[model samples]
Target chain A: MTINKELMKGSTVILILTLLDRKPMYGYEMSKEMEKSSSGVLTLKEGTLYPILHTLESDGMVESYWSSGEGERKRKYYQITKKGQGLLKEKQREWISFRTAVDQVLGGGPA
Target chain B: MTINKELMKGSTVILILTLLDRKPMYGYEMSKEMEKSSSGVLTLKEGTLYPILHTLESDGMVESYWSSGEGERKRKYYQITKKGQGLLKEKQREWISFRTAVDQVLGGGPA
Candidate 1:
């Protein structure tokens, strides 16, 4: 199924926060994890993902640091901050409310 | 709950179509119904709602006409077009897929 670009755009911050909530990750690793986790249903492009990362960082929702893991070249890894976590919780709530509202109207209701 | 403006922006079209799918509605009526039905989780301002309606009208997903019913003054009412219905189905599928993918990562799974 074709993913709605608009919806994806709206959920970008939450998606990034959700992934980073587990552990810190670099951009490529994060995108790969998202693809795998979504079972290829949501493949995020680097172009689409990086700018958003930068925005999140600037917004103080996320922070970045150099990571030089064993046998791997140094890369910038992103992690959600305490502020980010709170924002993530807020976002999650909003998503749930929006989903419930939409489902109520779209699902088994008077038609 | 604080509704994410970004997320709300993304789902505006879907929400409007879902309501219009039930029956034709005017601007004020649509906003009121959305607030009432969402249990006030979403309170769409007329300014925010109208621009979206205009965009949808331009996209041909919906059409508008002047309606005068009973004692009410003439008002512009909107209804979903065939294209809009097709789009609604696509949006529904996309929302489901997105929600499922999100649930997988956010739920009690490998962390």
Candidate 2:
């Protein structure tokens, strides 16, 4: 199936926010979680995910801290801020409404 | 009725890309289209849409031109580039797969 860039642009922010909502996670962990959650269908590259993490951090929606890991690797673990939580809630409502409209247009039920 | 920021982040890119797929639009038009398409559910602010549009333009995914209008308003119209088209296709596939997984986890069918 063809993936649309426009769609990704609309949704990536919310996806990242939702993932971070669970717990503080480093870039690698986030990517791994996405893969696991999506059953390997939503693999996130470091290149794509890192920039997003940085952007979210700058936006004050997420916070990060450095933590040491095995093999002496220092990873920046990110967690959602209260602001991020609020933003997440707002986006969720928007998405539901958006989905409902799209579904209606596509001749589907409100589900 | 809470909106999830995480969900929005994940999908906003695709939404923008898909909208542009329909026609070249300026920031205001894009916001309006989102509202119309989502039945007034996904209203985008200039604060949000402008930055995204600028970023997309800079990334070479979208190209823009100035178009003058009545009342001395000169609007910038943006069109997706070939690269943007390619990116859109990739994202569409990713969203489909991601949605499929999310549905499975949520105990829903692969609808």
Candidate 3:
């Protein structure tokens, strides 16, 4: 599925954090896993995911290290930082609350 | 609560459509109603809402008309066009599916 761009915007951090919290993975691997695990719901383009990964690293929400290997084998692997984990929890809670709020409105506001 | 910025970005269209679908509303009214209905989960600044509203109008998903009155009383009210209603249904479905997909990943993939 082509993820809605707008929803994808806000969900970037949580999704990254959620995936990284499982295990460290390189960008290409992360991209593939996002699609596979999500049952093809999220397909991350390199252009979009790279910048987000860089920003997350700079923000200290994630950290990356070059794998020790020859040039052809080397790749940057990202792991969620402690801060990222905390934010992930918060974002998850916020997501649930946000969804409920929208439902209330769609259901015609407060009962 | 201050919404997670990214979630707000993706949710912009649906929120606007859902509210305007109920009845015609001016920008200010829509902004206020967004906060009220979402329990303050989403707060749209005029800068942000204006651009999206304009985009929706340009896309023919919605239409706006000025109230026939004095300058102070005149305000442009937006209503979701038929195309918007169809889009709304599609977006709502995408949102639910997206949420479930994320949950599947967060739960550590297939059981």
Candidate 4:
């Protein structure tokens, strides 16, 4: 299916926040994790995910540090802050409520 | 609970696109719809929602037209385009996959 730019642009932020909530990870690791976790169903491109990472970092919701691994390549790892956790709760609440509303409408109630 | 800015910023786009999928709505109407649909759980502020609406309109995912309603209010109504529909489908798929992954992790299968 064709992905629309508008939808992709809007949801990128929440997706990143949600993923980062799991643990601290670098950009490449984050992208790989999303792919592996989604079983390749939701592959996040570097082009799309990096900008969001930068944006979130700038917003201070996520903090980063450099660390080297097996390959000896230094990579920046990201961890969600206290503020990020709070935001995740809010997003979860909102998503549940939003889905419920859609279900109500789709369930054949008065539109 | 205090909502974090990062999470809000990230999910705002998907929220707007999903709401618009229900039917054609204007900015004020969209904000009101989110509030009403979420049972006041998710309120969309004009400050945040309008810019998104503008961005979506510009991106061609949504189209707008002016209509005068009661009290001589010339409100611009927005409707999702075919491209937007494609986007909604992609988002739905991605969201489902993303949530499933989170569930697996939270379920303690492997962490």
Model 3 residue A101 CA deviation (Å) reads 2.4
Order of quality (DockQ):
3, 1, 2, 4
In candidate 2, what are the lDDT values of residues B50-111, reduced to their tens digit? 88888988999999999876676788899989999898777766765655654443332122
lDDT of 3 by residue, A1-42 (tens): 677776777777778788899889899998998898888988
Residue-wise C-alpha lDDT for candidate 3, range B23-68, written one tens digit per residue:
9999999899988887887788899999999999999999999999
Q: Is the docking of candidate 4 incorrect, acceptable, medium or high quality?
A: incorrect
The alpha-carbon lDDT assigned to residue A37 of candidate 2 equals 67
Provide the fnat value for model 4, as a fraction from 0 to 1: 0.07
- Report residue B71 deviation for candidate 1 (angstroms): 4.2
What are the runs in model 4 whose C-alpha is more than 4 Å off? A1-110, B1-3, B69-71, B109-111
Cα lDDT for residue A111, candidate 1: 48
Instruction: Give one digit per residue, the lDDT tens place, for model 4 in A34-103.
Output: 6666555455789998887887788888999998668788888898899877876666665555445434
**In model 4 chain A, which range of ten residues has the least summed lDDT?**
A102-111
On residues B1-111, what C-alpha lDDT tens digit does candidate 1 reach at each position?
546667676677778888898988999998998887777777678999999899999999999999867997999999999999999888887778877876776662436
Which tens-of-lDDT digit does each residue in B5-40 have in candidate 4? Answer: 433444566667777787788898878776666565
Q: Which of 1 and 2 is ahead in TM-score?
A: 1
TM-score of chain B of 3: 0.89
By DockQ, the better pick of 1 and 3 is 3
Give the lowest summed-lDDT range of ten residues in model 4 chain B: B102-111
lDDT of 4 at A31: 82
Per-structure clash totals for the candidates: 0, 52, 4, 1
Worst 10 residues of 2 chain A by lDDT: A102-111
